[model samples]
Target: MISYNIFTLTNGLRVIHIPNNSDVAYCGFAVDAGTRDESENQEGMAHFVEHMIFKGTEKRHAWHILNRMERVGGELNAYTNKEETVVYSSFLKEDFERAAELLTDIVFHSTFPQQEIEKEVEVILDEIQSYKDDPSELIFDDFEELLFPSHPLGKNILGKPELLRKFKSNNAKEFTSKLYRTTNMIFFVQGNIDIKKVKRVIGKLTNDIPLLPTYKIRCKPLPYLPIKKILSKETHQAHIMIGSRGYDAYNDKRTGLYLLNNMLGGPGMNSRLNVSLREKRGLVYNVEANLTSYTDTGVFCIYFGCDIHDIDRCISITEKELKKLRDNKLSSSQLDAAKKQIIGQIGVASDNFENNALDISKSFLHYNKVEQPESIFKRIELLNSETLLDVANEMFSEDYLSTLIYK
Candidate 1:
């Protein structure tokens, strides 16, 4: 039910705006570059650049960048993933120009001073250490390493400390110059602003960016091999992850798998995994399923933390649930209920203007158009129980699924 506008600047940066009556505005850039784009030697450069971007720019110091929006009661933030990097902000609607200009400055004009790089690397090293301390969290990265094997997609987004220390300002600048082309970026805004004004503001500032040719091509991961691994770690509870390579973003069956994943172990308390593992049996504290689909491949995983004594029981129960989905089609009432649950969840999530803005930016970046909620709902509605069963059988087959455990 949301509406938006999109246009391309002469510099090739695409812009999208979602009209709303809210007093707060959300704006940012979604660059079609991320961890996977880095060369082997580059390692953590993408994420390092994200942190240093706000440290200093041509016109502003780190302190100035931090206070520019806060002085106006706004917030700025950015994150990098396997395939994309997003820099965004939330501020009062009237300060749209201020937020947009600041985002532009940080993304394109950041100086990435050595002082900032040295300080930030220490911070990130601490972050990497903290991540290692949490098995439940670190297990996901290990699971991805198993899924993608030696490929860049499998490497942790937080690069190694040794490589991180070697990164210089020139390395970051070169990476950005090579990958962050105007054609590979999208400026997204959500608020009560006019699209024409957004076009004018972004167009004038970005006009100086030379039109550059797109040169990045992502190499897909090798054929998946189902591998089972258990690593010993000192922890109070055993963490388990089991899943397989799944349908990519472009697959027609992706929607069906999404619904199936929701019914099995989504956030809802009534999910089959939660009901069977937690509410009924009291076997574990939490259980959840996650599906991450990228440009050319996807990862579908279920993670649960349980006592060492309960690990086998938990795995058996999880496999049993997967078997149920693969062996039996949902009844009409069950299918309808599953569809409603996910649709309602999506509807609730769409109310967050910030997330919606970021989502549309990525959508436009990948698919070149924003799909309305109604459109997504229609696709979900078109999915049938047989389709869900087929996807479950294919994606959840024992031969395809891999298991990783931290004990």
Candidate 2:
């Protein structure tokens, strides 16, 4: 079992410390600001601002910041998602203080130099082009575009190149100042250190975050209506993705969906979709399903790539497999197999302490507490075939799923 302690700063930055026997520590800030927080005028601003954050800070130049942990053979990295921005690092256990101080500097005090912002805009624009060049990957974004047609949730994180080019330093500063509040952040660390010491370090590092009068409030958008779209592309193979809006992270149905998705098409080779679509019929080379849950909504999708000539047959077979899950209740033996398989998969994945820290931080952000592995397994075991079929009935209903195809 993983044990952790929590601490809060005077302003509101929550800190989590998980002690481990490992020599390397994983620590950083998990900011609550992301793409969905951007306004219409700032389509790509969240992601753009994420890139500029490392450009420079009030105390440390970009180069110095880059080498702060690297000099000690550690790494500093960050990423932007639809709902959060994470700047984290993996460093030697003794360098925990150094890592915390540097991360605090970047997240709270980035100076966003003018020249750096300008250059990064061109780089991000290039990124947008690279994504468009791959139809299989691009189709997922296009699918969400159709699903959440008028909402920020639908906007690609790599915003429009034209809009990105016009973003100035102050623009990023304004977004950061308004959204990156002490009240909206979490400091999570895992290492071979005393819990009290970790708390003290985080408290001191975040002692200066300003206390804003109001919190950033993002209203949940209306649920998406199902829609199908076709994009004609000059590509070597046809790609298809179909899915419906799924239960949010907070919903009870989410656990069932997690198991159902894996049985249908998870990382393992024996997944129903992989076995039926590739092993037996040999319709396509790549086929998989993914489930993503956010604070207020989720997107579940199945993507497959095949020769254009085999597209119709693939879709037919895919629907047949989904129909089995939706209409047929699993036998007791089948349910037990799936439950044990997923439990083992989760167990194997939990061995990575770095990923464990990241997941724990995100869980705290959402549920305000981290659930132990045993509790999670209990919930998974309690779910019956009826629960899974019920979820499949809703998530796999033809009326709810949308299709986006690139051919």
Candidate 3:
């Protein structure tokens, strides 16, 4: 069992602390701002700021930050997504305070030094170039642009190269000042620790954050169209992605969608997509589907790669199977298997330190409280064949946006 509590600090920062009996300690700050909050010209500033935060802070150099944490056997990292930016650290329970202070310092005190910012910009540019080289990454980004043509949801998290070229030290500093304010941040700590102490530390750390304009931005819906895009790339296999908009992260029906995704392609060995496409017909090398849940909107996608000659056949077969789920009845045994798979995955997630943080923190952000993990199990257990069919029909409903990219 986990003991947890949450409180709003005097500075308007919400902090959630989860206490474990184990020796490992982990903490993170989830900032409720990301690409969706960016201006058209500042597309990837959230991600860029995450990189820049580690470059240097007002009191410590980059190497000093690394060395100090390393001395205590602590690990620190940060990441930016479409809706949030998370900076996290892990260390022995004895080193929790040091780890927390270092994380807070980097995120709250980054100076965005002129020399370091120049070097980091080049690094991000090269990272963007590297993604362009990887067809899998490029195709998904293309699929998103294809699916949501006019929305920021479609924009790449890595801001466009041309816009990034114009960014300098001052631009990053200004953006960070505006984006990383205290009101938009939530501090989360999970491990063997005192709840009162956790609250005290966070309150003390964020007390002086300067006030700024609200960071929350309402996510706009995607304009789905019956359009197809094919990018010509010289590669051995054609990487194809088919996707459409789906439900929001907080939607009640998401659990059903999770079960549906598993039945379609995520049941591992027994999944229909893999069994029929890869094993029976042998038309493609591999097949998979994903439901990416986000703050205000979500996406359901099926992706695969095949020999150039097999592209058309692969797409046709994939569509047929997707439609089949809508048209056919799911047997009780099949539904049971999918439920088991999802439950097992959730069970694994329950014990994971980082994922536990993700599960609780995400629930708090989305539902305004952490959902008991058992509640999910009970929901899945109650899923009958009839309910399964209903969910499948609703998920693969008539409205869908598709994107395809090939060599």
Candidate 4:
């Protein structure tokens, strides 16, 4: 039973509160600005701006902010994604207002100092280097590039090093001023607390924040290129990712796709991609299919890692397994197993306070509704073999497929 309330401030900020029946709470501050908002030269500005928010606020220095938060044993962190940026805190219910003040101050009154900008730029440069050193992360970047091509969405969230070099303190402030507005942000707080009080506090902090300008995100349509696989010779085991476009977050068939993804390659062990390829043939190490949904678009991807010499055979087997899924419906027994797996996962996630908080936040942020666990379970339970088949056809359709291999 997740009950919540939403309040819209005069400044245009939308504050949401979900009070749980537990002692601990999770608070999340999400902005609707992310990588998609970056200009061509400012690729990754949203993510860079995220790092700057913690540098200093009007009253609190970076170290002071952490010290104060830690004194109360509160957990504070922030992240930037393709469509949003978020600063989050988790603490006992007693520390909620304190945590909120610190978070709001950092987000609203950051004083992007020149020295701090230079220092954080180098830090972000190191972070980019770290990602480059890891083949798994690097190759995913490659896959996204191939999927989106010239679009800003195709660009890495960690803007290119050359572009980072061009970023000055003024640019950081400009980006922040333009994107981090009351209209562009959504605040979410969940725990055992008074929703009315939370709303009042948020309303005070955001009273003067202005609306964001109307800017259209331009993502030109990219045609499905030919299925070409590139092998990198420097790696040990072969890492592969195949993908194509899929539906936005609100698609009705999303629940069906969830079940179909399980049947294909999901959960811990009882999945077709793992069962057939790893258990029976003993050919591959691990394989899974996953989907990423956004506001305007989405992507469905299948990834696997195997021995370099077995790459061809791995690809053949993977394609065979996927084609089999598209060609045949799940058996009644298989359908039942997938439903049980989904229901069990939902139950486990909801039983805990923190997990349930995140689940509700994800619902409000992505799907715009707090879908009940039982409702989702009912959808999974009632869906049959035919629904799974239809989902498979929609997701695994061959019109726009791509594969990228890192040796």
Candidate 5:
């Protein structure tokens, strides 16, 4: 069992403290803004800003910011996804205060220098080119593009290099000022932390933060439409991704779908798809299924890479598994084993301190409360075969699936 304390500052910052006996501390902030918030013109600003913030800040130069943690045998990093941007770090418990102050500095006081912007733009352009060169990496974005036509959600997180060149330091400042609000952010820490001390240190760091009111530009919810396209690419193996929009994170049906996805093609080699496709016949080098859930929407997907000639046969096997899931219910023993497998998997994942903090922060950002891992297990326990069958049949139907292939 994990124990955590939740508090909100007067400036509207939500902080979560999970005390542990370990000497290393993991801490970070999650801003409820990302590529989804970017306007068409601002395609990559959210991600760009994430990189820029670390380059320099008002109180610290880029050197100081990078070395602040490393000097103490620590690490600092951040990432941007479609819906959130996170800045996090790991350090010895003794450097907790230093880590906290350094994080606060970068988040609130970044100075996006012109020189840094020019250099970073080149780096980003190279990134875009590299991403384009890898069909395995590029097809996921292409599949989403096919599914969501003319929508912000469909745009690549890494905007085109031409548009990225137009970004200046002022653009970074304006974008951060608009979206990085106290009300729109949460802080999470897991380590040998003193809750009161953390509150005081972070309180002092956030003292300068104005109680900025929140803003959200709600994108019109996208309607799911299945479209299939095959692209001829210069590649060693044919890559395919098939999927459709799925249940939102808040949907009651998601728990069943979660379990259903795990039973179908989750990470473990024992998954149904692996058993049916890889172990049984040895058709592909890699095959897996995944589901990405957002606040108001979600995506259910399966991805695989195989020989060009084997593409049709592998897809047929995949469809057969889907049909079995859609048309029939798992037997009593199979259902029990699936439940145990997913429950144990969730339990093991919760042991990851960094993932726990990040996940809890997002949960609070979305639900206004943290749903304990135990709560998830209970929900999974209540999921009967009937419930799973309903989810598989509805979410896995052939009509909603979209396929993208690179050959």
Candidate 6:
């Protein structure tokens, strides 16, 4: 079992630390602000600000910020999602203070220079174009837009080019000043450093963070009507996505659905979808199921790319598999095997220290505490066939599912 420490700073920023004997350390900031937090006018401002953050700080130029950790054989990176943004680093344990201090400087004191905004916007625009060229990846964004309709949750994290060109430094500053707050951020560290030293270092660096009032409110998406969409595109293969909104982060049924997704189309080659589409019938090269849950909503989707001629057959087989899960409970042995498989997967994943730190940070961000591996294993162990059956019936029924295909 991995042990961790959690504490709150005087300014309301929360911190979590995991101690280990490794020479390398991982640390970062996970903020509760993301694409969904943006106003319609600010379509991709969250992600835009994330890029600009590295461009410069009040005291450091883009070059200085980029090299701060690298010069010492370390790395810095950041990413934005639907409901969260993370800026983190991995470096030698001796450079823990350097990493923490640099994270604070960029996240809190970014200058968002006008020249950087212009350059980064072009880069982001090119990125948007690259996605357009890959129908398989672009289909997922189109699917979500179809799933949520007019909601902000449906907006692509990469905003439209017309809007992207109009973004200025003021836009980034406005977005950050409004959403980035001490109360909405969590600082996380993982290394062999002493807990007291971690707290003291973070406390001094973050002491200037104002305890701003919370003004952010995430409105849950309204009920969605299922729709089937087939868009014509110039591609040799058909990329399809079939999914429905699943449980939120706080829902109890999420655990069962997670288990069900793993069995259906997880990363393992033996997953049902992989075996059916790739091994048994030789229909496609890749098939996988994904579940992405937010604070108040979630997305459960299955994606596959296949020869255009095989589209109908693949959909038929997919539906057949869903029906079987809804109609019959897993046998006692099957359930036991699934529980063991997922438990073992979780154990393997926990061994990745970088991902483990980020995972625990997210857990703490949502629940105000980190759940141990044993706790998660217990949840999986408690899942019975009835629970899985019910989850399948509720979430995987044909009526609740929506289909999006790129042909």
Q: After superposition, how far is residue 147 of candidate 4 from its true place, in Å?
A: 1.3
lDDT of each: 0.92, 0.88, 0.79, 0.78, 0.88, 0.92
Collision pairs in model 4: none
**Model 1 C-alpha lDDT per residue in residues 1-407, reported as the tens digit of each score:** 77888888888888888999999999999999999998889888888888889999998999999999999899999999999999999999999999999999998898999899899999999999999998989999899999998888998998999999999999989999888788888889999998888988999888888999878978989999999999999788999999998889999999999999999899999999999999999998999999999989999999999999999999999999999999999999999999999999999998787888888888999999988899899999999988888898899998999999988
Cα error, residue 276 of model 6, in Å, equals 1.3
Residue 88's lDDT within candidate 2 is: 95
| Alpha carbon lDDT at 315, candidate 5 | 92
What lDDT tens digits, residue by residue, belong to model 4 across residues 80-185?
8788788888888888888888888888888877788889999999999999888777877778778778876677999889898788878888877877777666
Q: What pairs collide in candidate 6?
A: none
Candidate 5 deviant stretches above 4 angstroms: none
Per-model TM values vs. the true structure:
0.99, 0.98, 0.94, 0.94, 0.98, 0.98
Query: How would you encode candidate 3's per-residue C-alpha lDDT over 1-407 as one tens digit per residue?
Result: 45679887666667888888879888877887788788778888888888988878989998998787788788887888888888888889888788888888988888878788778888999999999888877787777777677677788988887887777778888876776776777788888898878877777777787555555555576455656778789998899887777677777777787888887778476778898779998876768888988766788888888889888888778778878878877787877777888899878867778778866776665455777768889988887767667766766764554767777
Tens-place lDDT per residue, model 6, 1-407, is 87888898878898999999999999999999999998988999999999999999899999999999999999998999898999999999999999999999999999899998889999999999999998888888899999899898999999878888898888888889887888888999999899999989999998888888658978889987889999999799999999999899999999999999999999899999999999999999999999999888889999999999999999999998899999999999999999999999988888898999899889988889988888999999999999999999999999999999988
Write down the TM-score for model 5: 0.98
Model 6: lowest-lDDT 10 consecutive positions:
211-220
Model 2, poorest ten-residue lDDT window?
A: 208-217
Off by over 4 Å in 6: none
Query: Which tens-of-lDDT digit does each residue in 251-354 have in candidate 5?
Result: 99999988888987898889999998899999887888888898888888899999999999999999999999998889999999999999999888887877
